[model samples]
Target: MSRERKREGALYLCNQRQRGEEGKASGKEDEREGETRTD
Candidate 1:
C-alpha cells in the first residue's frame, strides 16, 4: 500500500501548498508520478 500512502501524503501536501499559493510544485510532483491534484 505504499502507493496509496504516497497519494494520501501528496494530497495533504498539495492542500497545504494550495493554501500557501504554491500548488504548482505539488501538481508537478504529482504529475511526475502519473497522478494529479488539480484545482
Candidate 2:
C-alpha cells in the first residue's frame, strides 16, 4: 500500500473509534434523561 493511503486508513480508524465512544456516551445520557423525565 502507498504511504498516503496507509496514513488515511489509520486516520479513518481513529475517527471510527472516537465516534463509537461518543455514541456510547450519548446513549447513557439519553437513558438518564429518560429516567429523570419519568420520575
Candidate 3:
C-alpha cells in the first residue's frame, strides 16, 4: 500500500510540473501574438 501511494504521489507531481511548463509556453505564445496584432 505504501509503495502504491508513493507512486501515485510521484505521478501527481510529474503532472503538475508538466502543466506548469505548458502554461508558461502558452503564455509566451500569447504575448507574441499580441505584439504581432499591435504592429
Top-TM-score structure, candidate number? 3
- The prediction achieving the highest lDDT against the true structure is 3
Candidate 3 overall Cα lDDT vs. reference? Answer: 0.90
Model 3 ranges with Cα > 4 A deviation: 28-39
Worst 10 residues of 3 by lDDT: 22-31
Q: Can you write out model 3's per-residue Cα lDDT over 1-39, one digit (the tens) per residue? A: 999999999999999999878878777876788899999
* Whole-model Cα lDDT of every candidate shown, in order: 0.73, 0.89, 0.90
Candidate 1 structure quality by residue, lDDT tens digits, 1-39: 999999999999988878657646456665666553343
Better of 2 and 3 by lDDT: 3
**TM-score computed on alpha carbons, candidate 3:** 0.66
Cα lDDT for residue 14, model 1?
89
Could you give me the TM-score of model 2 versus the true structure?
0.64
Q: Global lDDT for candidate 1? A: 0.73
Model 2 misplacement above 4 A: 28-39
Q: Which stretches of candidate 1 lie over 4 Å from their true place?
A: 22-39
